[model samples]
Structures are given as C-alpha cells and as structure tokens.
Target: MANPGGGTVCNGKLHNHKKQSNGLQSRNCTKNGIVKEAQQNGKTHFYDKLIVESFEEAPLHVMVFTYMGYGIGTLFGYLRDFLRNWGIEKCNAAVERKEQRDFVPLYQDFENFYTRNLYMRIRDNWNRPICSAPGPLFDVMERVSDDYNWTFRFTGRVIKDVINMGSYNFLGLAAKYDESMRTIKDVLEVYGTGVSSTRHEMGTLDKHKELEDLVAKFLNVEAAMVFGMGFATNSMNIPALVGKGCLILSDELNHTSLVLGARLSGATIRIFKHNNTQSLEKLLRDAVIYGQPRTRRAWKKILILVEGVYSMEGSIVHLPQIIALKKKYKAYLYMDEAHSIGAVGPTGRGVTEFFGLDPHEVDVLMGTFTKSFGAAGGYIAGRKVREGPLVSV
Candidate 1:
C-alpha cells in the first residue's frame, strides 16, 4: 500500500526529520530513504516520485548580510574611482590616447564598473577549470590570484575526487559508458567533427534525420526539428514563430535565451510573475481586452512561454493549470523542457508525461540534449505540418 503522497507505507509509523535550512521537510519510514514533501494548494507532493521542489527564499539574515556586503563593496568602489579621477590615486584603466578615449565605450559605465569592481572581487569562485569530465566526481585545478581575482595562475596542484555539485549531469551520462563511447567514436569517424555548412546548404545528414525521428517518436509528437545548439533552438526559432503585431506572455524569470528570442521576434512582450497562474490569467485578459496598443487591432497571435522546470529555481511549472488557462484564452503554448527532460516524469519523457497531459495540448515542445543526455544540441517537436493543404489535425 502507498501513503496519500505516494510513499510506500511501512508497518511502523513514519518519523519526521528535523527541517532543513533550505526549507525542505522529510518524513521517512525506518527502512527507506528520506522522502521530502511540499504542501501547496492543500496538496502534498512527495519528491520521491517527482524531482520538483518548492521554491524557497534565502533566510532573512542571509539576504540582509548579502545586501550589506554589496552595499559596502559598491561604496568603496565608487570612492576608489573618485580618488583615481581626482588624481589622488593612479587610474590604471584610463585610456592614454585621445582617439581611444573619444571612441564609444564597448560597455556602459555601470557594466564596466560592475565587472571591474564588483564581479572581479568574487570571480575566483566561478569558472573553475576542471581537469576531468563533469561526472559525479571529477578533478579541478588549483589556482591563485595575486590581484584580487582579476587574474589567476595554476599552482601545479590538483584537487582530485572533488564532488561535482554543479554540472547538469542529471543521469550520470557524463561518465564514460562503453557502448555510447564506441558509438560516438564511430559517428565521429564518418561525420568528421562538424559540417561546414548550414542544413539547407548541405549540413543535413542521415544521422540528423534519424535523431529527429527518434526525438519525435520519444516525444510522441507528429514531427520534430533538430538544432546544433541548444540556445539557438530558442533564440533563433522564436522569431520564426511570431513577429510584430504578436504578443508574448512570458514568465518573469525565464532563461536569458528565451528573453533574447522574444526581443528578436519583434513581438510585444509582457512578463507575468513566475509560476503564478493568477498573474498569467490577468495578463491574458488584459491582452484580449486592450488588443494592440493605439491601433487597438487584434494581435496576429499570442504565445505563452514557460519552462517545464526552471533551471535556477528548481521549481516545476504548474503545467495542468497553465494548459487550462491557455485553452481559456485561446493562446498557443511553448514549453522549454531544457532542464526537465530526462530528469523528471514516470518514463523521463518530461513534464507532459509527469503530469499525464496530452502532448498535443502544447503547441511547441522545445528541449536540449545537453542536460540529462550528456550530449549537445536541442530539438523542437510538435504536430506535423504539411507543406500545403494537408496539415496534421
């Protein structure tokens, strides 16, 4: 028998563990592993069956200290800059030539100040060079920075067996697999690294076709299109889907790639609160009633952009509710499952499968192979579109 939240019921009563600092609560049977539960909308969701976790904010003290630190840093940074400009100290970044000084700055003052003063101080913690594949355990090189993380040099020492806590190797596919490595080598011998042309100009290969077919089959969709780069899958294709006179309702915390794509699409973009159905509904209602601004003409199309699992927040999308809302407002839905694909769901088919929702309900299903598959590229899947009269129904 199973508990109401879908955990296995033990003969003994479940014992509650102390609450975690990150706001996770667990109840476990004596024999089984810890099972975390989150309560929302009067429903208990167990993480044992679903990988999604409730969004938790940092503790008040943590936020307070973080802001204080930044404020102090900014204050000192401005003071130093002021001193340099007033000749009290040397201005190391000052340009020496008139032509160079007159040339338009590559970055705005705020951006340049941020990189030089703020980011440079804490850059040591980011972009560490790894010596091994990003598996469960890997090696990272040791380095030292003499100028407060502005530059670093190797110390000829390695931190081996370091736990890789950050990489998106969700299924451990980054580790060497015998058959997969052999197949990859075989394909490399034939494909020769990369095609020197775009798909339309001769880049298309038999493997591309095979991969698209497999993606479509796996997604249970009518057809699929493959792209070489995952970021391009969103940044490039969004423009093809909608343009000026169209309206895009996007989550406020969506990935930067999606934001870029929406801007490039020339669509009127309105951001709704992240994972908030009420906010989304309000936006949709306003869009319908107002129509296009000034002209008051109906929009050519309306697209709702959301992610299956938001990468940074680790909060799963409320798909069922969003689908219902999409239908209510007659809006097309585009789901980016970049982080959720192969990491969630009963069979790892992604959020659609996780929620037992029909794939056809979503107009566009976009995902990347880089995360769980430990591979490169991305795909877009949806109902098959015929060239002419016979579009898939």
Candidate 2:
C-alpha cells in the first residue's frame, strides 16, 4: 500500500522513496534494499522533502494510537485489554515451548533469557528520540510500527519538540553552558586528545599535575590521584588498601564498583544496613570482638566503606555518625562521592563541606567528573601523596 508521502508499506516493512538527483523521480526501496544500496553507494543521504506515512503496528505504537483514540472519544479500552492479553499469551507460549531449540534455556543463557522474558515485554515500546542538540528543551521523534522491534527496524518518525525531564546534567553545566564549552574547546584545540598511557608509563601531562593540585586544594586534602575511569578508581584501589587478614565493613547499598573492589580485596567483609549508624556500630563491634573466623585473632586492618550520597536512594550519608563509629572502632574510612562531589554543597565542595566536617576526617575520598564537572574519569584524594602504586598496611 502507498501512503500520501510516496512511501510504501509492504509485508511489514517500510519502503521509503527518494527523489534522485538525476531527475524528478521517486525510487521506492524496502528496508533491505535501502541497506544494500547504502552499502553499494558507500553512504546514504536522508531527504527531508520525502515524507513517510504509514508504518507497521508495533505493540507500543498500537497502545499509543489506542490511547489517543480513547482520548478522542473512541472506545479503545477494549483494544488495550486485548493487546495486554495477547502479550501475556505470547509470553506463556514462549515459556511452555520446552522443545524449542531456538530459544535458549534460562539457566544456560542468562542474557538471552532476560531479553526474551523481560526485555521483550517493553521492547520497541517507546520512542523518545532527541533529534536536536541536548538542551533543556529539544525535538523528540514519536513513531510507532508493528515490525518495529528493538533489535530490528526502528525509525524516527513524527518529530515533536518537548522539554527534557531525564538527563544527567546535575549542575546544569552540560552543553547548555557556553563558558564551559568554550573552555573545553580551547583545551581540546591545544591538547588534541588523551595522554594515551597511564601516568606511571609517561602519560603524566603538566595539566594532570595542575588538576590534581586544584582538586586537592578544593577538597582541602594533602594530595589527590586521578584515574582514567571512575569505576576502576574504586575497583582497583580497594584491593590495594586492604587484603586477606584485614576486615571490610561496607554499606549494604554501596555502589557495585565498591562491592566488587571489596570482594577482590580478599578482606573479611561484613555488611551494615545502609545509612543506619546503629547497624554500622553493631557490625563494627562484632568485627572488633570476633575478629577473623575460627582464628578469632585481631584483624590486621579494618576499613569502613560508604558513599557520600546513595545514587539509587537519593539519600545523603550520615557522615558524622559514621566518622564517630570509624574512630571508635579504629577503622579506616573510604567514602565514595561520585554523585555528591560536584552536585552537593553551596560551593559544590562535596559531602564534607555539606556536613560542615573536615575533609581529613575521611581517610580516602573518591569522586568522578562525569556528573557535575561535565568531564570524564575519577579521582582519589587522601592525606599524603604516595609515589608508585598505592600500598596500604
């Protein structure tokens, strides 16, 4: 079938027509034809003049159209109910097909199982694409199709301008800020790209030293070491700080990186209820009294790990209470401020400044530049600057 825009809908595929430069001609091609043509031509161009019309009915598109029909005084509640039932039936059929070799067993293939069982439920369900620059408000393409699977043919159709509600521009210093962009551009022009190697292996730029000094001055710490990755900062450093005979008391709701780091450290790890000083104290007391399992000897070292702000919970950590407990238990404190560092406090100095506490109170301070700083990588701040790889006793 042909739409008003000279586009064709054939066998659950979109056939787009383009006016070739040779003449006033409309060449209709299916999805596969378009892909093959692009491969032959080495590049493909999108014609703004050619308007596409009808598309296949994907589940999300169907629901959207059904809802719109209801809003416009049509009885679509029954249709919505029917679609839900259909989806449930499809799910049930997939689950019951034990002999189907195409579908991997849940135990054998975890990712594929999740894709089939969970992801498919809402796959191609929504199209909130940003067509223009990522600002406070931008253009979103609203399109629906039956054959529009997430893993298959998904296209941007029916563009509409809307305000962005979901974004990681925590401090409003992203693309919207001109000064930051200009500064970044200037730096990019001068520096080209990355340093290309780890700092130990001749990757240390003068800019690196300046940044570390600035971070230390800002955090009111003696020294700071920056890493290329925020996640790796925690993952790699935790193991260096504590090991075998040492004990690690971690917040139950700590970030995945911290959990992984603690696990790799080979430390006797005990979890405390998130943000609960009482629970933390109990765990500390028990660890101090019991020590290692079977041996009951004193731990070589005790490390208390927590976050300045819980990213998932949106709750601030009880730093004062935790600090008191750490002091009482004689445990080193490691605070991850990935979300809090540049997003909290009047001057954006992080949780330490927010809580009116000294930065030195926390043994190790960790944060990332991906959020408020609008940069990449992470940093680890501490009392003294150490050369080579960090080694904690």
Candidate 3:
C-alpha cells in the first residue's frame, strides 16, 4: 500500500516515510511489535534514536533497510554478487569437465584454497557482534557454529558481560562513560555528527583547532596537524614529508600504513630488525656512507621510521637508543604511536614518556585517537612546519 506522500505501508506499518525533502525513512517492527523508524538524511539527522533503542530491546535480529533512488547502487550490488557466483560456477564446471591430470594450475586455485580452508575457518570461529561498547568488560555474540560455510547463523545465546580482552580500548574510555557521553552528546547536538567537508575546505571547525592544540599540549610539541583518519595520517603525510633523494630506514615489523607511505615517498627504503637499535644503526651508517643508489650522491634527508609499540608483537620500541642513533647520524625520526599513545607511560603520554625521553627528541610524533581517546582519526606533531598537499573528503 502506498501513502499519500509516496511512502510505503507494509504489514500495517509505514515505511519509506519522508518528512523532509530528499530524505528516506525505513521502519521496522520490533520483536515486541513496536514499529521504529530509521531515517537517512543527506547532511544531518542520520538514523532515528528509536531504531537504536529498538536494537537494545531486542538484540537477536536486525532489520535491513532497502533504499531506493537512482538504482545504481542496488544494481552494482547485484552485479557484484552475480559476477562472483558466475565465476565460481564457471570454475567448478571447468574442473568437472577436465581430468585432474589435465588441469592447469592458476592463481585462483591458491585463492580458492585459502578462502575455503583458512579464511572461512577463522571467520566462522571468531567473527561475531559485540553487544556493548568497547571497554574492559562487554558483551559479545559467541559463534556457535564449527563449520566453514558461506552462510552461518548465530545462536540467540550471548556471552553477556564478559571481560573484553580483545579490543584496543587501552584507557577504558569507551562504554559511553558519563562524562564522555555528556560531552559527546553536547557536541552532536551542536555539530550534528560531522562537518561534512575536509579540513582544508569549510570543514575546519573551531573544535578541530582546539583538539589540535590539546594534542600538541599533551605531547609537548610545537605544532600538530590532525587528519580525518589514523591510517591516512601516516599513509598520506609520509609522502609529503619525504620524496625522491631521501633515505628511509624503517622497522621490519612496522605497520602496513607506514610501509605504504614509505613506498609512496619514492625514497630509498631499508628495513632494520624490529626494535633492534643495533640493526637500525648499522643500516643508518651504511646509508649515510653509501648515499643514494646508482647516483652515489648524498641524500637530501634520512628518515628513521619506527612505531611506539609493535601491535603484532606487543613490544615497545627502544626509543632512547634509537634517538641516540638518530642524533649521531643526523637523521629525522618518525614515531608512530598508534598503539602506545594512550596505553603506555606513567600518564599515557606514549613511549617517549615511558622511556623518560623528551618528546622533542623525536622529530615527528604520530598517533591515533581511536584507542585511548575512544575517538576516530589521528594527528601528526612536529617542531617545524612543512607544507604538503591537503586531502579533501
């Protein structure tokens, strides 16, 4: 049934109801037969609060919204699924038509094997929904299935109120603590979720400047630049800082973002053993002595990149020793404190504070707000300013 305003009424409930121009309202009936609406607006008022409240009341199932528009998005989604199924069917048909001895090995074989044997197995056992916000303790839906199938169902049974040992909520700031939630609520009411523009454009809010200043004060740095994403903070800015004719000494076990940024910098890259100052020193000395490859000319700059904490190994960087080597070699140091910023040190000032070294000793201090601050995005801090291309979202 269609309403007078072009909204659809399904199962005695109104759906796709639009109160404002160019907006969508998707309603779902809760388990208790209460109809709740989820709204999607272009710039503001995304999702109604009642939809979230409905989820809190009945956590077993979720309603998927069917959005209508130009149909391009829906078409693409169906096209992707169709192509994927077609490829699988074609592969299976080819295997059946040919003998095992006559089969030609392809890269798809490895991908298929890994997808079926490894990824599916791990995903089936581990992937589940966390009922509560991230903190030291929360609720998670425990996977009840042991099989590796494409479609799997979760049991209504929830491992309620379990100690959260998996997430990176370092300072236990998540779980909507009273003070944080109050501040967040006020901000949301004023800002309406996001600025909807890039920092270089009209998106630069007073809060952005204030947060940057606060981060600089906390890290004891001269200036800081905040990015929209933690991963982009490293991946995008590294290319701006160093380019061709520079030498990059990176830790072997550095994060992939750092690796990508270093590669994009178009500099000579060398990897040292993880957290090994001796190996770093050796690489630094060799680079300083040999200079750039083929050209044999002195490098414009030498950048030593390491992380505050190795996320995979859970080992903190040897900052003091690394700083000493950087000073000796006249190399600039870039420290990624994504994991250590709010988790390490006496007061959570990161690895520099934990090692009793001055933050100024490190040339560039980079960290993410996702961990301890219970927020998104990242920041880059430095003593001097270097102009680079600004990324617009």
Candidate 4:
C-alpha cells in the first residue's frame, strides 16, 4: 500500500487502534500525539518515520508478537507441494530438443496462393519504378576528428562486414576494449597464465588482493566477498546466516537461484504475495501473534529478499519504502541489484545511488558486473567479514 505519510519518520508497533474487540492482535505506535495503525489484516504498518536505529538486539522480542510462531522457521522451497508440483510440471512441460519440431509440411496445392493469385493482384508491368539515387548521407560532428569523416574506412566484407556483436563479455571488460588486457598480459608473463593450484594450495597471488581492494573501495562497504560462479553467492551466505529456525520471505518473482538457496538453508520459507508490503506485514503480524505462545527455538529469524531491478519488467524497486517496512517489522533486508548498477541511477551507482540511501542502510547488497561495467563476474557488498579469502580453492 502507498505510504500515507508526507515524508517523515513513522514509528510504532503493529496495532489496530480501534480497540481489539475482535480478539485479533494489533499494536499502533503512539508518540507525541501521532499514531501509526496496523490494518485488521495485521500484516504490516507504515511508520510515519524512517528508522534511525535498528533493533538488532530485540529479535526475540519482535518474535513475541508472532505468538504459534507462524513464520519463525519458514523456508522457500517445497513448503507448498501444490506450488512446487506446478512449477515442476511447467519446467518439464518445456519442449525437449528431441521431441520439439519446427518443420512444417510443404503443401503443393498452396503454390497457387503465392504466385498466381497474390502476385497477379499487384502486378504493374508498364509503369516505371521510382529509383532516384541519393547522395552519401553525412553527419556534422563539429571538431571531433582530424579527417571530418562520418566513419572509419568503409568496411564491407561479405563475411566480416558488420560489427561483431556476439561476445559474452558482460562488463565491457573484453580484451578488445578494456585496459585490463595489457595489465593481465603483463601479469601472466611474469606470474604465468594460470595459477598452479587452488588459493590454499598455491594459486594465491598479490593481484587477487589488488582486485579485491578495488572492489572494496568502489563499494565503500566494510568488506567485499567473491565466490566461484555457478556455485551462487546466496547458497554460500543464506544457510550460514539463519540456520535451522529462520524464515525467508521471497517476493513472487525472485530469481530461482535465491529460491534454491533459501530451500537448501534448511529454513522455513514463507512467500509474501509479490511486492505486496501489506501482505508481508500481515504475515509478520501473524508470526507475532503465533509466537507469543512459544519461547526461543520456536521462533524464526526473518529476512526479506527482493531484486533492485526486475529483469523482465525493467522496473526499479522502491528501496526507500522497502527499508521503511523492514524497520517497522524488524526484518532484515537483502537486495540484488544485478541489473541496476551503471544503468539506472544518474551517476550509475546502482539502486542505492538511485534512491540516495546510505550504504549501511541496506543489510546486504548484491550485483553482477556484466552489464554496466561491461565485464564478467559478480560482487557481494556487506558489513559482514570472514577470515581468509572467500573464494574456494
């Protein structure tokens, strides 16, 4: 739901201020004569204020509101078999290479349709077709080059005339373009093209630290972590953060990698209707109402996950609003800006820069370097630190 506040910090617990005559639970934060209400659904409430302080120490207290501890340990996968089965069926339904066919049977009788009936309808034999040659089209780029020509030597080869476009270079860091080519070449000449062993064995190089430092400085975060591709960063971190009794809140359209990671974490998965903040709040409120009857392990830590820019829609996430919800509900927030950096924001600083949020404002920031930076690989920027190199040998 839209934030009703005119832009100010709103604080309060989730409360239905109309008086709990229905035996349903609710809490409204009231301070200085201002009140924030929790709708009857009891999902989430909009605080009139931004959270200047995070209640990291009071996770259990927040769980108290979720009295069966409804969502304490909910994970993402296989929780609802109907959904999982449906997804599996859909995935399996894809036409396999062997069974799929694109050829259409040729119809001899249809030959009359193309040449006789259709061609005759538009035939004009005597009329002269207009063909006037136009002079070479040119652009007026003032003071750009010494030759003042619109293009380089006209390159028109039958096999190689057009610009090469099929390079899998995402970060624009291809050897054909980036200066890193020469730097890497020199390094390879001195250190050899390949490291003989894993990082622990002997693959370690000073260049690794140099690249890591650059990433750390660019992100301006406390620590930066890198990992092997295809293995996925979510799998590496999610399981470690939540353990057995944790809940992962996934948007309806979250990428499959995250869905899989959350499942593998062995945590309970509770899906909030996609981008429905109100629904998320209701689920959390339900958790609070349910958790009140339990203690400790009965409750689950909550984490909200979303993408900074959805690939299908090219729509950007509203980070400020999401941050607000996280504060009121006391949930951790994780955002994947894989498609956002170097493309959306004015200065191309990714979602945070687009929204003007502080780096520490988000719990974790993840993005790939393929698009805007025009290179390969991805990066994870967060406050958490781990000893030794993050990549596996």
Best-matching candidate per TM-score = 1
Number of the predicted model whose lDDT against the real structure is largest: 1
Model 4 poorest 10 in a row by lDDT: 126-135
Q: What stretches of model 1 exceed 4 Å from their correct place? A: 1-53, 83-100, 386-393
- Pitting candidate 1 against candidate 2, the one with the higher lDDT is 1
Cα-lDDT of candidate 1: 0.79
TM-score of each: 0.82, 0.67, 0.68, 0.54
Candidate 4 regions off by >4 Å?
A: 1-175, 191-204, 292-300, 384-393
Residue 236 displacement (Å), model 2: 2.0
lDDT score for residue 214 of model 1:
93
Question: For residue 378, what is the lDDT in candidate 4?
Answer: 68
Worst 10 residues of 1 by lDDT: 9-18
The digit string of per-residue lDDT tens for model 1 on 268-366 reads 999999878778878887888889999999888899999999988888887756665676577889899999999888789998887666687788999
Instruction: Report the Cα lDDT for candidate 2.
Output: 0.71
Cα deviation of 131 in candidate 4 (Å)? 37
Lowest-sum lDDT 10-residue window in model 3: 46-55
Q: Give the TM-score of candidate 3.
A: 0.68
Q: Report per-prediction Cα RMSD to one decimal.
A: 10.4, 26.0, 25.1, 19.0
Q: Relative to the unseen true structure, what is the C-alpha lDDT of residue 237 in candidate 1, on a scale of 0 to 100?
A: 92
